[model samples]
Target chain A: MTRSLTTVESRLRKQKPDSGQIPFGRTFTDHMFVMDYEESKGWHEPRIVPYEPLTLDPAAMIFHYGQTVFEGLKAYRTDDGRVLLFRPEKNFERLNLSSERLSIPPIDEEEVMDYLKKLIDLERDWVPEFEGTSLYIRPFIIATEPSLAVAPSKMYKFMIILSPVGPYFSGGIRPVTINVEEEFTRAVKGGTGMAKTAGNYSSGYQAQEKASKEGNADVLWLDGVEKRYIEEVGSMNIFFKIDGEIVTPALSGSILRGITRTSILELLKEWGWTVNERRISIEELYQYYEEGKLEEAFGAGTAAVISPVGEFNWLGKKMVVNNHEIGPVAQKLYDTVTGIQRGRKEDDYGWTVEI
Target chain B: MTRSLTTVESRLRKQKPDSGQIPFGRTFTDHMFVMDYEESKGWHEPRIVPYEPLTLDPAAMIFHYGQTVFEGLKAYRTDDGRVLLFRPEKNFERLNLSSERLSIPPIDEEEVMDYLKKLIDLERDWVPEFEGTSLYIRPFIIATEPSLAVAPSKMYKFMIILSPVGPYFSGGIRPVTINVEEEFTRAVKGGTGMAKTAGNYSSGYQAQEKASKEGNADVLWLDGVEKRYIEEVGSMNIFFKIDGEIVTPALSGSILRGITRTSILELLKEWGWTVNERRISIEELYQYYEEGKLEEAFGAGTAAVISPVGEFNWLGKKMVVNNHEIGPVAQKLYDTVTGIQRGRKEDDYGWTVEI
Candidate 1:
């Protein structure tokens, strides 16, 4: 943590994309934050260097055994011409949690946070200022050992990269139909389901593709055990409103503890709304809908603050909610979360930090 | 499949490792097989080049989403100086199976096997001729698209690397102790456990470390749903001999279809042994041990041809098998498989291809 940071600026800078044309994760900034870890030296020689490709041995452990962890958060550009980061420390802390589950060696989260801030400050101009546009930050660690051993690697490389991203929904927010996935299992207990590791993301693609082919926007994954209880949807934590009560699945070992989910819970508690965090089965959800009690359903995650669910397809049964319209609760939560992120709403808690 | 293979010989030929001193997965050969896949041209430009590091974009999908698959096989140098590959085509077939599960674009298995034969022929000198030594072949495919999207990568790179591996049991073939892991799950029915993908290996390291700390050689993972049915042990498929019969966990969607496991079943069938491939629960295994019906237990995989299980610890209960020594069945299987691999025993099946 005491190592002096080094900086190497790029000689030629890339032209920033036009305001409205910015894509998600396709374009990068000028520089990136990098650090290497060895068993003897630990994490050392933190540097901010020009964005470039990574050169690694073909037998690097990451290429064979996927011993890697990643974290995602965004840097917002406020209307007042100031740059802000929303809960960056939480991302670093979660990254460490992910590393532990994958058997990766521990990293000092505080020092990495400091290094991330320095890199963001140096690339301040890359923070898109257009409405709903921000710089997406990806901090990841890959095993760098040039060996094909099945065990954890002794060497690692930690890096933080910036990507200018446009809005999640370029058009107005709309509700999406989600099929209750009964065939594929995303995560199970005592697995890497809760960790923000690499494997968890791509494993869900086949299910996602199936739902897309069936005219559904995403797949609402059920619990891996009995395939009855609700877990998550796509890459987000899910919530539902029934009979004026807001409910979300509890933090099961197989469910990811989303930062956006945490923020929404805090907001809901402050608003004094009736909320419950417990197991909810798909049968019960449908029963409630038949009884005219089901109100709204939405997903919460970093990618989309609140992805409203319009319909649920369980087996061949189709159940519609909110008349296929975005509910008021989903709209308010999205606005409040995005508002706080962009520094437009009052920062009651220490959520957004200015650089 | 008719594309002619190209070769680029290495100018700086590195010295091969000393016999009997070779480590597992380290000390690569001078050249390797490489190919690229793009949406436009498909898998093209199959060439063999010097073994070197891979230069990839930082935003490569493999670093973010873990979309990759790999296979492991070995080439043995017969006593007559002929390099023979044992069932190399099966490895390529399984690699495609793994690629399907990970959503990676598939490659023509026949074409890849042809390219691998050429690479191994060129690196023939690197094959260790010491007793119990062989050339390890690792064929891996990585998602190479330089984007952070959570989907199947459009660009990919498939490469085959070679390493000279020493004998698995360099000292002598000794029985290993394994633990029945109750707290961790290796694979569930609907996950990537059936696929030899990158993520499945590292995710089990924590359990492996726990077992190692408890003075056990590896972990015996159970099914994820109930954590009762036997799944796998470390990275190998497990088999148990009970009441004069051999049994292994059925390939019920979560268990890997190991090549060694397949060959053992064929050999057992030819020998007219009573072999059952069905779901085997931990409770039944312990009960059989209590009744003195448990005879022999061993792990089947590529690294260790026949890893005998002398002891098993299941929730604090220790059950010693075959009096802490390799069983007769395990020894016979090992000698038979390795004998055929080394061209010592007659191979009735067309399992080995000589170059």
Candidate 2:
């Protein structure tokens, strides 16, 4: 699919925010990438244009049916001014998987990667120079057909937008508290849990908000069917270490296959650490904690890389892990991952792409 | 809170589609209702505006998080030029319930009803007079906050768009064939199943599309937990007649509380019919079929008030209901409801609201 690229630069540039005050997703770059899809022409007219508001018919299917999917990744700036992206192809691959599940048409992954690289190169100046700050890239597709029929959309708009964001954890590395969700379930087996679609996130607002109000940083969801086994936490994949082994929930058709989770697993295996991917029930975890075998727990995602879980509130009982401090395993994983991301360590895995 | 109304009429009116060719949600009225909500200031600046495209930032929370909810109803034009709405308040009440589940601010039901009435009266000419045609009204709210965080939006836009639509069943009142879904559960017991939000619909598209490809009109979703008990069919609540009694699935925190379903149950109980709302498993229903006790089956929703089930395919075995004909109960319910809506029958239930 050979396509010509068009550029429309912004005439008036907005002032950049201070690095110290940079917030997540509150600021945008000057340019954005867009492409349209029709049943007849397929994806066409790929272009980079000035970032602006999208004009859509009030009856667009996306607003009513929520037929949309999105991906999030960041571009880091090295101390010497080179920009690096950590496993961006994985994000687009997941996006296509989500599109398949939602019945949206697929895009050319190779071509889109080329276009994404061009987009990042064009917006390279927006990449923050601070150690922890980076340019966040959001690639999403929305159903734009103006109809009320409950079916797959005939028209779609795929876009890539850039936002300069501060560190996910502003105050530095800290262990957080999580509440075990017993009433609400995020996704079930044989559902859209594996897909990174908008519906999965929206359905979790109630549980997430409730947890926030109860003084917990996030909610740790259990399996939808039995409600005993651990699934994931908030928006990240969770891992638990018990009896000197790392255990994470296996892909059960209802858990998001986070890239960071996969990378962490690979790193642990390469280091000769015992890693297991299987169902770990809440009862079993509690029993392990009582026996002093549970040593560490953390969440893995693109946003925070690795967020340590210091405490968990299950029903009425509270269990503190590692005395409310970051465990050695969690700290090493975070440092190694972030070090590779910022180009401070050797890229032996060839995970970073320089543009 | 009191909200002042403003009007902006379209300079040029769109040509109305032929009554016979009017497709569902394809054609719109000249004006629409709009309101905005902020964290500090509640819903304010309620107004009627010309039908036009909406401009939103690329990073709006709705596009990424799918924090959207909507309602569907219609306005019928009687033979004597009078317009009637059937239990419009119920739709708003359900919308608030969905708002609460999605962490959105609730709208004043009474005040919003007044605004809806004014908007309907202003566009009264757009209401179709055809027997089976009416003006389809869609009220929706979307998160407008420009952020990529997974939390609920701090800003929202509530709007109502009117589309003149023909009957859902274009040919006639023929029964529809549905396939029993063996995979892909729609919602679970503690999920967002009761909310009429966008995620629920989008997540079911895969199952619906697969059913359509298998020569079925829709998919009959079973319970998400065990996939044994019946839940719903496509977007409607389902009912079955076994041994001369009507049985529908009770609201078990997962099934939608459909207004039409409620009305049908009320009418049946008032007429001295045995109606039961309880769990009905697939195995039990099949057993009743084998004993020749299964008589009638139908689905109820706002679009198609009563859709008879002609046949059901479960794991390649087909069961034809009433020789693939519309059952007597379904026909009667459709007639009674449509007649009351069009003012041709007595308003014994006081459901019709004249505009």
Residue runs of model 2 more than 4 Å from their true location after superposition: none
**Cα lDDT tens digits for candidate 2, A178-205:** 9999999999987888999998997888
Each prediction's TM-score against the native? Answer: 0.99, 0.99
Best by DockQ: 1
Residues B115-201, candidate 2: write the lDDT tens digits. Answer: 999999999988899768999999999999999888889999999999998888987578999999998999997888999999889
How large is the interface RMSD of each prediction?
0.6, 0.8
Clashes of 1: 0
**After TM-score superposition, what is the CA distance of residue B249 in candidate 1 from its true location, in Å?**
0.9
Model 2 clashing residue pairs (backbone): none
Please report, as a residue range, the 10-residue window in candidate 1 chain B with the lowest summed lDDT: B17-26
Model 2 DockQ class: high
